[model samples]
Target: MQTKTRRSMIIIAIANGLLLFGYGLSLPFFTIYLISQRGLTSSMAGLVIALAGLSRCVSSGISGELADVFGRKTVMVWGLFSQIVAMFALGLCIELKVQVGWMLACYFLTTFLGAFFRPASNAWVTDNTTPKERVEAFGIIRIGLNIGWALGPAAGGFLVRYSYSMAFFFTALLYAVTILYLNRQVQDNHTPCKSRKPSFVSALLSLKDSRLAKICFYVVVITAVNSQLVVGLSIHCKQYLHMPEYYIGWFFTINGLVVVFLQYWATRLMAKIRLSTAMFIGCALYAVGFGSVGFFDGFTLIALGVFLAGLGELIVSPGEQTLVSNIASRETRGRYLGMLMVFYNLGSAAGFFGAGLLSDYVAPHYLPGPWLIVGAAALLAGWGFWRMRRSLTDEEDGKTNVPVPIKKDTITLN
Candidate 1:
């Protein structure tokens, strides 16, 4: 990689680490905060989270076009700053002992802001690197993210009990620092926009490669499976497996450490494997990990399930991002990224809400019903990725120099 590109990657990774550390610090406790502090019921807390997911989905509706038109850095800066404001605002609610309604408003706004930068950051990575460097580049970024994920909660676990407001304040400060870092180190990497604004429908429907849509759909299914870790897995551990709350946190800690220490090496090893094959293996791992969770009572078995799921995440995360970049044209990369995230956001919502509903209504008597359903969905989706790969040309896989050009645009790294 060129020096400037390498520099940008480091800056991006650091910024992600800082922001996510702050985010992770407060996030795991948010449901507890709402229920304990605001006196909301369990169902209400889940509803709030589901609503935030919906807010993120709606806010992201046009973010891709905005990033493409205005610039990646411009959109990212706006998103980061707004998130700082939202976090502090939520903290104020906690400090003042405000109504649950107020807390929900702040929560929605915070996640809405997140919708912009999630895609923008990934688009920025695609802008800075070539097809060949993508997996390693994304791997580096994932480690940065997981570092924050690991450390933030460990620190937050201590700080939150002392002062919830203090934890939120620290998170806000981290976001402020990330804003400054991004403004100084990252540049607007998108090409100059066309004179006319493109409508979302036109932009999506205009895609020359139909294969991108199929891949994104698979992304939705897989991500839905992944989302269960946050919703169903925790409940399963506490309710059926008889794991304590403290140990639940340890499970996440273990998952984050595995990703942080192993992501780069894993990405490198899997780089030589076919993308579709890697995805098949990954999705199968997810199925086995999550499915086996329902059948086991042993503590070691539960931990094994968590570790296997993390391994699956390590395999798929970069592969999916690299695959998207390969399929998208320069002109439409941001839009494609945005579209993919819609599925991600919606899938998250589905996992949270769907798992809860299934547990309460469909499978209250059966311990493993929710797990098996999502696990089977993921297993089938893995097969779908393998099926899709059979139709891809050598050019799409970067095995040949033959380019799949749908639009003419100069790619610049600042």
Candidate 2:
């Protein structure tokens, strides 16, 4: 890419890494804190976590429209600042032994604000790059994100054991640094805001393009299938395969580290292919990897399952982001992306909730049922992408920028 773009990508990557690190540092022990220290029941803790998921879904589309109206850098700065405040507030609560209600408020605000800037940052990158460069740009950012994921949980584990307050405080400090660094270094693309258009209904209407709508549906399926990797996969490894808890932990380590190491290479490998084709291959890998888990009997095989799924993760993330960017006009990019995020958040919440239910109810009664269901979702998503491949011909022929007029509350793309 250009020197200017490279510099901007580096800054964006660093900012994303810092944000994920802060979030991850407090994640693993959150439920434990609620149940053990705060005296909440298991169901209450789940309810607390569900509130954050709900906030993300509700805020995503709104934030995307705000990004378009207020400008990407402005939304991003404010979003990061909000996260900083939420993190520090949570930390202070831990230090002061504050009530559960205060912790819930802090958590809700953090998740809500966190949803806002993602589409803005993503749109900022989309604003800055051509269709061809976006895949690599997104891949580099994904690598930076995974780097935080790989390291943060381990650090959080230590900190939670030592002092939960310390973990929250350190994470808050990271967010503060990220806010300062991003505000100083990142430049906005300055797409003119549509002053005449009302945002809420308009943002929802941006998905009127049939192609974009289908892609969003496919994302929901794919994300639902992938979400099994976190809760369902971990439980299956420990409960059925009889792996040690430490061994189960290593499965996630393998997944994250593999993506960190191979994401860019996978992006390069898929760069020359059509985006739909890459997505098909990715979804297929996910189907095969997770489906094979049904037959595996040992820790090594489970690790291999995670590895294949990790490869799929590396291939899918950048490909899908590039596709969404290609489909959107520069002016409505954030809104389109935000619409996509709404589907993603909903899918993730369903997937996690469904996976837990399946693991608890189905896995015990029917060993292969949950894996088969997840694999089926992936296959279904792959088929959807294959059917939608025709829509991507425009991007392939360099017609991705063909203007689509944004009417008062609707976008019509040719």
Candidate 3:
């Protein structure tokens, strides 16, 4: 990689690490907080998160267009600044026991603001790296994110012992630290397009491509399955299994370890397979891991499930980014990527909402109901990918004419 490209990747990675540190700290606790402290039912808590997540999808798409218009650094700085204020207010609400509606509004605002960080940063990575370098580039980025994930939850585990509000306060401070560090060391090397502004609706328009749309829909399925990790696990274990808070924090930590240690190698290995095939495999592993967790007892046994899910994430995350990167026109990279994330967040929205309802009405009556339903959805999603492998393989063949700076890796992905 060129030094400048590598430098940008490193900068984005570190920035992502800082950005996600806050997410790791608070997200696992959010569902429980709403239910326990805000006097909401589990379904209501899930509804709030689902609503916020859906809004975030729209904001994420818009952020991409803004990034293309205003530049990556500008959008990121704006998002981070906004997030700091929102998160600080969220902390105060949590600490002060404010009205549920106000507390939720702050949380919703944070989720919307959070949308700004990823598409902009990921687009920055796309701008710097050639197609051949993107999968590993994204892997490098995920490593930094998981590094934050590893530490943040562990720290939040401790903070939650003192006060959950502390996690929100500390996260805001972390975002400030991130902005300060980034401004000093990172430069806005990517230029905004002058030829024409990308339409804000272009992200929506791009979804007309059936292949991309299907994958996006599949993502909704995967996220619905993945939602159980937070929405269901926290409530289930805490209420029934009596799992301690520290163990839940460590669950996230172990998943982060899987990514930090194995993501690069896994990304390379996955690149050797057909993209759709790899996605299918990822979904299978993800489902099996999630399913097994509901039946297990103790932190160690549960960690095994988390470990497997992490491996699934290691493969799937980079593969998704790489597909969008391969298919995107240079000028439209941000919109395409942002479009993919729109579906990504949509999956989270569906997952959170379904998880909430399942946890409330189904899980209590039939403990395995949530996992069984999600596991079924994941397997079905995997089948969708498996069926699409040949078409996806065909699309990939058409995408590779761009001159590669690096030699083709392994079997060239078809």
Candidate 4:
């Protein structure tokens, strides 16, 4: 049974990798497309992304509760199938040169539907792995995720010179293929919680657990900081640094490579330290990486910045995930993760909008301004995590240090 579960874990990781690959191939180009093709201002584009993120946070948070009652596979299929349609429609919007409003509508749908599969799939992973094993397990998943990240942009860089729409079409194709494999090969490994059904708002109640709430807040801040890479980097390089699209793609590919190679080792290292300590360290690295970008010029320095951020990612991300897994009982795992993702999306929204504001208003007067702001935020989040160390614990060691997580859960709406 252990072996089978392990195999399923790998399979799920592969499917997830395919999804990330599609995203890397196409989604990274979204801001660029919106600006260059559709002619939206930087602030306007950022606003669009922020709103889309709002949609994602709500959908994903709600989807988690849905996953708890419905089977993981059921929710996964629903989200996956729907996302494919949205992707194709998005592609058509791009290909046909549709109105900006239509394009925005499709993109919003795609982002919102994208949230559905994640919590369910992640819950499936939690179901299969022991709390002790979750860091390494999530590390494996991250590896799969970054492999696509590594390759997708390099391929996308080349493909975009020809057609941005093609990248979208390719993304949809990859997702379709993943769905086929899922139906044929994968089983619903997670059994649903039988106790009571839940509503979308129920996941928000989990925030009442102060420790869990802290973790979710950290995710928001970090994810926002990380958004500089996704939402701001392209604009920064193209507009300020004067780097071409392909080079930017290459740099992102390298960043993903860093995560892929180092993630497992980082997870192992994180297991030795308190999860909060690891996150604090990771955030410090993020500050150093992203903050330094503002003070320098040229590809080499920027690449260095991206590399440091990647190092931060490989370290904290798995440990952070393990924390959530450790905090939730098995029955509530899906909802717990779902709630975490809500913050993740919210962070993305904050990042997107914040980056745009910095870029539009600040970058013109001070080239390093946007990146410096990003750097400062990263450091602040690191400090926050360090202080929260007492509230968290190490799962595998079976030790309770401080901030013993409250045993009482918030009531879920029926």
- For model 2 the local lDDT of residue 344 reads 80
Tens digits of lDDT, candidate 2, 2-102: 88887788789878888777766775466556755787654455456555766787788877888877888888888878877887888888888877778
Judge candidate 3 at residue 379 and give its lDDT. 91
Higher TM-score: candidate 1 or 3? Answer: 3
Model 1: how far residue 391 lies from native, Å: 3.4
What's the alpha carbon RMSD for model 3?
Answer: 4.5
Can you write out model 1's per-residue Cα lDDT over 45-150, one digit (the tens) per residue? 6667777877777666567777787888888898888888998998898788787678778878888887888788888898888876777788888888888877
Q: Candidates sorted by TM-score, descending order?
A: 4, 3, 1, 2
TM per candidate? 0.90, 0.87, 0.92, 0.95
Worst 10 residues of 4 by lDDT: 396-405
Question: Could you tell me the TM-score of candidate 4?
Answer: 0.95
Q: Which rank order by lDDT, best down to worst?
A: 4, 3, 1, 2
lDDT of each: 0.76, 0.75, 0.80, 0.84
Which residue pairs in candidate 4 collide? none
Instruction: Point out the worst 10-residue segment of candidate 3 by lDDT.
Output: 405-414
lDDT of 3 by residue, 176-200 (tens): 9988987887777777777656576
lDDT of 3 at 107: 92
